[model samples]
Target: MERAISASDANQRFSELLREVAEGESFTVMSRGRAVARVLPVDRAREQRSIQHLLKFVAALPVRHAGNWSRDELYE
Candidate 1:
């Protein structure tokens, strides 16, 4: 379950909140008593894998000579 914290409480207890999130706990920051933002641990492995996949996709594309064509030409 996500922990909820009021805006004022979050501001006052920022450090503690961060500690909880760093430990893989999720939080919902409330503004005007309504949930507005979320804090959670970074999924570094997943993020890195996604970045690597994107880079591979980009690298695999054929390089165009100067003034060759627009991106649409490559996909179409």
Candidate 2:
């Protein structure tokens, strides 16, 4: 579960909070008692990008680059 902290507290403990986030802890930064932002591990962000890249890779089909094969050649 994500930990919750007030915006002010987040500001005060920003460095430590960043360390915690880097270690895989998540947080909900609250403003006026309402959640305003979330902090997540960097790995999660990388994973999201990798997943998106993989999805695009599969969706594009014919997994090959143009270094040795041209696009038109794929149909031939």
Candidate 3:
């Protein structure tokens, strides 16, 4: 579950918040009683590897052209 914290409190305890996030605790920053932002840890290396894999997969896809057909033929 994400903990809700006021924006002022978040700013006042930024370092503490970072430590909590590093320890896997998540938080949502609130402004005017409305959620505004989230703080969480991320695995940069894993994200980059995933993106690279996606790029390679897309690059290997075959490119094909539609055979000669009129707009009306497509609708039919």
Candidate 4:
């Protein structure tokens, strides 16, 4: 569960908040007693793997052909 913190408090302790987040603590920033934003640490390994998968998928796509028919042509 994320800890809730008021906006003013978050602003006042931004550096400390970042340190906590880096240590695996997530937070929900509130404005007017309402949740406004979330602060969480990124999973670098997962993020890097996701980017690698995307790059590989894009690289494997077939190149376009000059005589290729559009989807409309297939429907017709």
Candidate 4 lDDT, 1-76, residue by residue in tens: 6899999999999999999999999999999989999999999999999999999999999998779789999899
Q: What is the C-alpha lDDT of each candidate?
A: 0.91, 0.91, 0.95, 0.96
Model 2, stretches more than 4 Å misplaced? 44-76
lDDT of 4: 0.96
Ranking by TM-score: 1, 4, 3, 2
Residue pairs whose backbone atoms clash in candidate 1: none
Cα displacement (angstroms), candidate 1, residue 34, comes to 1.9
Per-residue error (Å), model 2, residue 13: 0.5
Which window of 10 residues has the lowest lDDT sum in candidate 4? 62-71
Model 2, residue 27: distance off in Å is 0.3
Error of 4 at 70 (Å): 32
lDDT of 1: 0.91
lDDT of the structure predicted as candidate 3: 0.95
lDDT of 1 by residue, 44-67 (tens): 999999999999999999987787
Off by over 4 Å in 1: 62-76
Please state the error at residue 74 of candidate 2 in Å: 37
TM-scores, each model vs. reference: 0.70, 0.58, 0.62, 0.69
